[model samples]
Target: MGLTELLFVKMTGGNPILQGLLGGIVITLMNTFGALVVLVWHKPSERFLDASLGFAAGVMLTASFTSLILPGIERGGFIPTFIGIILGALALDLADHLIPHSHAVLGYEGLAQTRLRAVWLFIIAITIHNMPEGLAVGVGFGSGDLPNALKLMLAIGIQNIPEGLAVSVSALSAGLGAHFYACFVGVRAGLVEIPLALLGAWAVHIAQPILPYAMGFAAGAMLYVISDEIVPETHRKGHERWATFGTILGVMVMLYLDVALG
Candidate 1:
């Protein structure tokens, strides 16, 4: 009976806008699922975690540079791309300064409070970072570049697993509810993509000239995350070797995907 009802709901396709909305929701849910797996199951050593993060940083950085920023420049030329990158970096920097959080604290605090705060901060930062990625996915789909779109989506999705685990473990060490915290963190990280997708689609339609800038902006934002968030957090774990390994692994994985797909 329950299955029948669900099937009926699934079968009933609706308006175009509604379809897009549903697609966005599905994508968000998929991303969340990936994050949840990382959060609940994986218990990576500090060294491994740091290496994994370094790897993720490498993948994202490469993707931002080669896949997004360079392409935007090729399509839109240098001046616009430069402006976009600067604008994107500046926007995130401004947001970081304006948003109140405990990113400054390095040492230990009370376990529960510390973990809770860390979990929330990690979620917020990743959520912000995912927005542009989601936007890129949406733009790719909107532009009818289905192959590239899927590639980006898959890459980002796989990358988020390690990211989610990193956030979850940090929070857990800080003394948060493992499952609940993971779920919320995953949901928060994934949900931002919806608005990003919508906005990207709209921007592509309304200001075609700005697409290069937009891509550059996303690249810049991603670079900031690599520098400010991923690198620093990885260093905190003091696992330089694993981190380096992870970094190399991540780069290779992305490179393979780009070659196979792109």
Candidate 2:
């Protein structure tokens, strides 16, 4: 398909790249705001962190299906989406093998230990966790469906708040300064999203045939993060009950947003 046809959204002024950039910015800002939540909730308990992470997992769980997988099926058929999902999961799994990183609770994983400090390893984990989110937003915008894009954007941004809070809180638990470092993390997170957003938009520009696969890929990556990291980490603490409820609430919120936005 032609570039013009690929980006033909009459409602949003028909600029997928710009829309994709904005989508990335909105989610990044949401994450930044999430990080800043540390100021108010200062010294939030580990129990709270578990619940928040669970909440993030819930949002992602639903978002993976509603915003990515289902639409991908509708637009491009099930086979491509299924293949995309498998490929996406494998890609992240491969990253896990190739890149060593440490989680706040799960501790160190990936390639054998290097000189990376605990803080840096921790940052690596978060970065790897966040890349899919950026990719999802970019693909949503790239889909040329403004309503779905905005809905996905809102859900992802909301979920990000908890993630950002979890990150900043973890930083503080490690005795890192909250403002400078947290904000720095937020900026770094944005850097991860913006260019990737452009890339997603641009990728679709080159070939519409890949759109379904792209959407499925994003969904699968998110599903992997939720299952492998967020859920397990949240349950490791003593707050499993609260964390479960948090996930329920998060799922409800995303569901509400999906209905409301549409």
Candidate 3:
């Protein structure tokens, strides 16, 4: 069988589209697991949160390079991937410049600075960070390579656990009231992926040629988040060592999974 067909056999037993949507939903829901931590235990320490964010940054940075950009280079060549990366970075730069959002500890970013409540600001910050992950998942499936897409889904889902915890912590710090509500808010923040995944798959169907560019773009977008948002947020506090270890661990785990699953 061909590669896509073989990948299909390995994922969901046959249907790439169905598998794609299901994978997207499953990965996004992983966010709830982190949020659930708040219900079972006390809020995590700032050091723990910083490490988690750093871990997430590591995972995404690896995914961008190993999973997305390289595949784009293989499929569409160097020039396309290069341009896509630049465009992706530029797109994120524009969003960062135009939107107003607050980081976990870094205060407010984006051009449209505002006096918005901390909870809302936290939501905006995470939303911007996560939406691209959903897109990456979608693009993976859109590439018609079920195994690669599944790998991306697994990687992103695993990393999202820490992200969910970070979001819950941010909400609580913002005085978002009862632990249950904050956890709920954190889990719900990931729900945007449900639709975006489907849309990305559909876009792929409509324009198959764009797959390589899309992959590169997704990589660039994710890289932007890692460098501009997650890394800085992780290091803004005093847990630089823990965060560094977390980042190393995260990268190793993702690499292992990629090899094991591939």
Candidate 4:
């Protein structure tokens, strides 16, 4: 099958597991689409990247509460949800120390001068950052909440566009390859989400007890990424105004989606 066909095949929202897989594929495709934009722009403006990343940050920030934490508290109660949030944040914090994390602007953090090429390291770091997002989408589906899952998927997929473009531009800037191949790697980086999403759905399906915790955990992880990675990177550039504006716009869009869809 062609690349597009391969990725787009057999998406259904019937089974929660399948639905989770569908969510992963959808986000991946969105990222791919964004990366493809590099074909047109050749070199995306840093100001625009900062703004778009800011928008992504906003989406994840609001989504953490609107789609995850709030519903978690409603279903699982405050104590469990609160504890789950803390655990989630702690887990990501621990991961942050070992491997590097990446942003479009700031590049990799905590990366040592290892044998691994910076390009590979950058891809690995971005994949790590994306894991929680995949898990969040999966948990949303696993909760057996159709509307919530779909909304979560839509939000993530929408945000993935800019994220994907960022990866593509970064890869090209790193001289990873020609534009097509750079975007190819961008698609490859996002492929990590597929398996993680599946794992999330399976875990939630088998245990079911972890749904509330999963929700809280996913939300917490996303919030951590926002505070730790996205915000810092976006603000570091001289484009803080654009970043802030984009963030506010993203928040508004997500809130509207949550209200309109939920």
Best by lDDT: 4
Candidate 4's C-alpha lDDT? Answer: 0.84
**Sort order, lDDT high to low:** 4, 2, 3, 1
Question: How do the residues 1-262 of candidate 2 rate in per-residue lDDT, one tens digit apiece?
Answer: 3343344444347787778887888888888888887777777889888888888888999999999999999999999999999999998998877898888788888999878777778788888899899899889888888778878888888988888888887776765565667656645654577777778877775688999999999999999988888888888878999899989988998999888767
Candidate 4, 215-239: lDDT as tens digits: 8899888988898888887888799
**Local accuracy by lDDT, each model:** 0.64, 0.83, 0.82, 0.84
Error of 4 at 204 (Å): 1.3
C-alpha RMSD (angstroms) for model 3: 2.8
Question: Mind giving the per-residue lDDT tens digits that candidate 1 earns over 1-262?
Answer: 2442244236533222232234355567666665566544656577766776788787887778766777788878999888988987888777666554333224322122433555566556566656666666555444334445455555665676666566656555656566676556656767887877666656654667877887788778778777776777777656767777787888888888877776
The better-scoring model by lDDT among 1 and 4 is 4
All candidates: CA RMSD (Å): 6.5, 4.0, 2.8, 4.4
Q: What is the TM-score of each candidate against the true structure?
A: 0.79, 0.91, 0.91, 0.91
Which stretches of candidate 2 lie above 4 Å from their native place? 1-12, 177-179
Instruction: Locate the minimum summed-lDDT window of 10 residues in model 3.
Output: 1-10
TM-score of 1: 0.79
RMSD to native, candidate 2: 4.0
Better of 2 and 4 by lDDT: 4
